[model samples]
Target: MNDQTKTQAQARNDWWKGGVIYQIYPRSFQDSDGDGIGDLNGITRRLDYIASLGVDAIWISPFFTSPMKDFGYDVSDYCDIDPMFGTLGDFDAMLAKAHRLGLKVMIDLVLSHTSDEHPWFQESRASRDNPKSEWYVWSDPKPDGTPPNNWLSIFGGPAWQWDARRQQYYLHNFLVAQPDLNFHCEEVQDALLDVARFWLDRGVDGFRLDTINFYVHDKELRSNPALPLEERNDRTAPQVNPYNHQNHLYSKSQPENIAFLERLRALTDEYEGRTMLGEVGESQRGLEILGEYTRGEHRVHMCYAFEFLENRRAIASWVVETFEKLGEVAPDGWACWAFSNHDVRRHATRWDLSDAANRAYVMLMMAMRGSACLYQGEELGLHEADVPYEALQDPYGKEFWPEFKGRDGCRTPMVWQAQDEFAGFTTSDSPWLPISPAQAEWAVDRLEEDPGSLLHHYRRAVALRHDHPALARGDQDGLTCDGELLTFTRTDGEEEIFCAFNLGDTAAHMTLPEGSWTPLAGVMSDLEAGVMDLPGWGYVIAKREGE
Candidate 1:
């Protein structure tokens, strides 16, 4: 290869690019202390299992000190581990074990907000003249004692909460207890960067920045405009939430977020091989914001685009729209895609896919361009658990019951033992969330003993991406989502791979692209070179003759 070709190849092979990230919701992964909560030691014990999945890194959800208002997302202390999770020493052990197991540890960083109990918030709200008063977003009430503007919280009601001490209205995009940080304040940005440096100093690898697009808000605090009826979608928030009513023009997705991200990226760059994947938390403009946040160097390494994590069916056309739109908007930008995460319903239940269809998507994501994030229980084909009203935990769900059951169904404990009464997740009579009967049936122990289980299939699919350079960090082309089939090619200069998926239940067919291709084994069956017949949830990953 010439120098130019070698440089291009090197550019495509960044540590975070085209890698698979396993998202571990620490609370539900495994309970080690019989306390009914998964802690750092539990995760340390399971580092082998995570390594077994062949994922490059594990993006653990917040275990930072918090009041559990929004679980750990509402962080109280950025520098210390929550007592329920374990001490900072326990976190060090987990990190050491993960690194020893050949897995990178990327923690979820909730920089946009903090719990109301956080000292910073308390000091900021204690009085307006304090040094930390400007650390959080605070505004005066209107003449009539109404909120500053019409910005709605994702949890429900106005985004502004009246602070009695300061006699001001504070902004919170999600729950009122989770106050938004004032990123416009240079001191706040410096403090957040100092927090990043603290983690980096501790030998951590990277961060999954929560609400990357929400860091900066309109300086003038203008009211958001009303969203057109047709433009509102429930992908970001439930339909019951009037948060979807506004266009969110002044509330979020501001142009100023990029500079902050660049500063963040620069800090990460200081640590060799460290990566950052920000979450773009906008519904209508997710893709556009993703393109903006990740199109250039000195920005986030990747942004998790939410178009795939919808309640809608996982059809070919939808995939086409997302891929084509990303290609159009940010041809050079990178995306980290996931069908399921802590915030949304599991894809298996959200899309209502059959066992075979579920298998198809596992392979599809691994076969596509860019990085992929695999949720904890997705490989088990676990359906959304049935967490009744009385057992409900998610505040979002409790606010809008019946119509939207919230995310607890998806956040239930990871099923470890098929036959164990409690699925081996906890010894306590009552765990944080119930391990639903549906999830219990797909326990890891049972699948470990079964060769043909989706769990093994997930392992092989991950291996397939690792084995072939064309599948990982490759340039995708010939992409089409027609009828029931989604077809595309991934080529990394030296070789090319042809990938096809049938999202529908019934069998589907499409003429093979021009090539002498050989089907890869151990992924799916019933394959042919030409006139491919793909059964429902069936897929093919074939290599073109490389001579």
Candidate 2:
């Protein structure tokens, strides 16, 4: 290996590149104090379990001080830990334990906005002439007493909230309690950067930036144009959500966001092994923004859009088209792909996948060109929990009601023991959200005893990716789709591997590409000669004999 080759190898081994990241929704993971809510101490106790999954890192959802209006996303204090989640000492302990187990910790950072109860927001809304008054986006109402512009909130209704204290309207892209910060103000930008520095100094490995594209809004406060019915897709928001009616041109994904990202990247670069994984939430232009945000070194290291999570059925054609689009628009950029997370419906139930399909999807995600994220219960093949209407907590779901249930179903507690009344998640009878019967059946203890369980399959699949350099950090090529079958190739210098998937239930036959190959174990599939016959939801990962 020469100097250039050594440099390429080091880049490939960088933790964020094609590495597996497990997402832990803090409030639902485990409850150490038995208060029916997961806390920092609980996560500290489970560090070994997380590390056993063969993931390179863990991305924990928000556990910051907040009023819980939107859970921890509406942060009231950026530097402090919420009492419900334990103290700063508890967080440090968790961080130490995670590092000891060789798992990097990436925390969720909600920098685009802050809770209304935050001191800065309280001071900003106090009086328009105050020094911090411009810290948040505030504007005078229209002459007719309507909002300053036609922007709409993601939680339904107009995006502007009339504040009697300042006699002006404030902007909130999500819930009214979560007010958008004035990134246009250099002071606000500097303060946010300081927040990032605080966490970095505290030993955090990296950050998962929430709503990264919404960092900067249109300075002119222009109204967003109406989206044509034909162009509107239910990818970012639910079909019942009125937020999909507009194109959102002036509201988010603004050009100015790039400069702020460069500044943020520069800050992260100050520390070794630090990275940023941004979440882009646009419906039509997600890939384009992803490419722009991560195009160069001085920007977010990687990004993931709503495409895979929103697709009810990740058909072969859909997967092929998505990657093809990425290759065209973001050839130089990187992406962190995920099938489920804290905010959406779990893929197992959302897609109505069979046992085979579930296994196949996991294999496909691991074999993809970039990094991957696995939600907490995905390894056990847990579906979305059934949260009763009366027990719902998500404001988004509560507002939509029977028409479209909110995300509480997916945010339910993880079932650790099948026989425990609380599924071993907590000793308390009452959890934040009930553990559904379906999830209980796939409990960790139960899956651990079953060798053929989805849990073991996930473990082996993840390990296989790590063992094969071509699958983990190689460049993807030759993507093609034939009816319900999808095929692709990955190569890293002298090593080459072929991957094929049958996304349907019935057996499918296809002619394999010309190559002297050897089948790799762990992935489910059957191949004979040049003809490949795969059962429904079957897949194969093979290495070329001599490439």
For this target, which candidate reaches the highest lDDT against the unseen true structure? Answer: 2
RMSD of each: 2.2, 1.7
Lowest summed lDDT over 10 consecutive residues: which window, candidate 2? 521-530
Give the poorly placed runs of model 2, Cα more than 4 Å off. Answer: 1-13, 522-528
Residue 400 accuracy (lDDT) in model 1: 94
Please estimate how well model 2 matches the true structure, expressed as its whole-model Cα lDDT.
0.91
The 10-residue segment with the lowest total lDDT in model 1: 521-530
lDDT of each: 0.88, 0.91
Candidate 1 stretches with Cα past 4 Å from truth are 1-13, 521-529
* Clashing residue pairs, backbone N/CA/C < 3 A, model 2: 397-406
On TM-score, the candidate that comes out on top is: 2
Query: What tens digits encode model 1's per-residue C-alpha lDDT throughout 1-547?
Result: 9999887766543767889999999999999998888999989988899899999999999999999989998999999999999999999999999988989899999999999999999899989899999999999999999998899898998899998889999999999989999999999999999999999999888999998889999999999999999999987898888888899889998999889998999998887788899898888988888888888888988997679888887688988888899998889999998999998888877887888888888898898898999999898888888999999999999999989999998899999998887898889888988878767669999999999999999999999999988888889998897798898989987788888888898888777777677788423443454775676777778887753
Q: Which tens-of-lDDT digit does each residue in 94-127 have in candidate 2?
A: 9998989989999999999999999999999999
